[model samples]
Target: MTLTLTQTAAEAVKQIVARVPQAEDGGVRIRDTGAPSGFELSVAPDPEPQDTIVVTDGARVFLDEVAAASLEDRILDAELAQDGSVRFALGSQV
Candidate 1:
């Protein structure tokens, strides 16, 4: 359930969290849906049992139970599309 934060994603998450209330408790969750590409990332209010990485600010990022038991390494990257949309990608380092 290791997660990497790209400069773009870290900056964006920092900005968005700053604007929203209760964001201090919320975080971005990354998980592998067992897809062919790699993994899928989801944004939600913390994690229960289905979350991979529970990111809390720039201080700490961790792997949830499920994800930790599954993937060993993962990278969270940010991409800027031609349509002016920013997207996130998660891939297994293994």
Candidate 2:
């Protein structure tokens, strides 16, 4: 029901928000794919060419049709890598 954003994650999201004109929502939605293996994010199917994870600064973090059911508890955390890379942690909604 509630999700927490790590400082790095928040900064990343904020940076993304600054770039995109549509991401005025100011939050990211994380969704789970119904697949037995993993999850994806979005309100629609994954795009072609590359199946890489897609993230945006949109106010809403959409859950792909398949991802919605896989994830229940939602917590967004970030880790500042030694190289300054940001890592995100996704967990149950509990």
Model 1: clashing residue pairs? Answer: none
Off by over 4 Å in 1: 15-24, 49-66, 69-71, 80-84, 90-94
Task: Show how many residue pairs clash in every candidate, following the order shown.
Answer: 0, 11
C-alpha lDDT of all candidate models, in order = 0.55, 0.47
Error of 2 at 53 (Å): 21
Measured by TM-score, how close is model 2 to the native structure?
Answer: 0.44
**Model 2 lDDT on a 0 to 1 scale:** 0.47
For each candidate in turn, give its C-alpha RMSD to the true structure in angstroms. 4.2, 7.3
lDDT of 1: 0.55
Please identify model 2 stretches exceeding 4 Å from their true place.
42-74, 80-86, 91-94
User: How would you encode candidate 2's per-residue C-alpha lDDT over 1-94 as one tens digit per residue?
Assistant: 3344445566665554455555454334444544564553322222332222334332234444444444434566667666655566776544
After TM-score superposition, the amount by which residue 11's alpha carbon in candidate 1 deviates from its true location, in angstroms, is 1.7
